[model samples]
Target: MDYNFLKSLHIIFVVSWFAGLFYLPRLLVYHVEAQEKDAQAREILSKQFEKMEKLLFNAIMIPAMFLTWITGLSMIYLTWWDSFGSHTWLHLKLCFVVGITIYHFVCRHLIRKFRASEFILTGGQLRLFNEIATILLVAVVFLVIAKNTFDMLMGMGGFIIFAIVIMAAVTIVKKIRSNA
Candidate 1:
């Protein structure tokens, strides 16, 4: 298979995986918050959200994640096998990929907990948790785009700042919504 074709497929799967990562947390936020409603409404919304979460995770997220890994690893093996250790950017990107993979499984755990009527995190906390994917996305994209030329110190600083901004925004939004 062509390297470009593998890269393209990897890109597509990354996008799909990120879409699930982005939406699944929001669904969890809704699912957690739904518990605050009246009993009947809570029951209805919980069941619906659970169904949605299951469908999204099983049908979309898992497949996309696996494909992303397969294609990404394929590209790496095909292109970078000989000099993989020399690619600092790729190393960092793989770290971020691992982070996102952990995030993905944490989400799976959350889904199981929700299914078992265990609401461990509040809506606000889940809202903050949702930002993990966004942060990882930024880090991975930046590392890939700035490969080799990327300054480690500046990149880490920028990543920290970006994360702070995102968390602050989420906190502010939560406060604003609570006030309203």
Candidate 2:
């Protein structure tokens, strides 16, 4: 098959993958905020998000990531051949991609609990998480673009800070929910 065709498909898929990554958390924010637990609205929201995630990965993200890596490596093999292993940008991108993938899985587990009515963050906490998610996505974009700088460190640090904030927000929200 044509390399250019694969690369084009790869780019399209990647764009779709990132689009889903961008939107899913926002949906979660809405899902978490709604007070209609075990109601029709909540169930609909859960199903919609589940469908989105499934399509995003199976129909778009996974294939795109695979194509991108394969075509990218093929291009590298055909072009650089020898020095491809030492490419720092590629390495950095790999780290970021893998980290995001791990986060995706963790989010899946959490969202399942959410769907099961076992865990639900309050509206305010959902807002906080939404903000943090936006920041994290921005940080990821910056890391991908900058590729080499104190920015990568900043991104990692941002992730840590956001993680802490999420934890604290969870604690507070749970307290609020329990009290109310």
After TM-score superposition, what is the CA distance of residue 62 in candidate 2 from its true location, in Å? 4.0
lDDT of 1 by residue, 114-172 (tens): 99999999999999999999999999999999988889999999999999999999999
Q: Give TM-scores for every candidate, taking all chains together and pairing residue i with residue i.
A: 0.98, 0.58
Model 2, 1-180: lDDT tens digits are 676776576567556656655665666666665546678877777677666655654665566556656765666666556876766655666666676666556556656776676655655555555454455455556655675554556667876787777668767876887799
Clash pairs, model 1 backbone: none
Give the range of the ten consecutive residues with the poorest summed lDDT in model 1: 86-95
- Which ten contiguous residues of candidate 2 have the minimum total lDDT? 127-136
* Candidate 2 segments whose C-alpha is farther than 4 A from its true place: 1-4, 36-58, 120-180
The per-model lDDT (C-alpha) reads 0.96, 0.62
* Candidate 1 segments exceeding 4 Å error: none
Counting clashing residue pairs in each candidate, in order, gives 0, 0
C-alpha displacement of 153 in model 1, angstroms?
A: 0.8
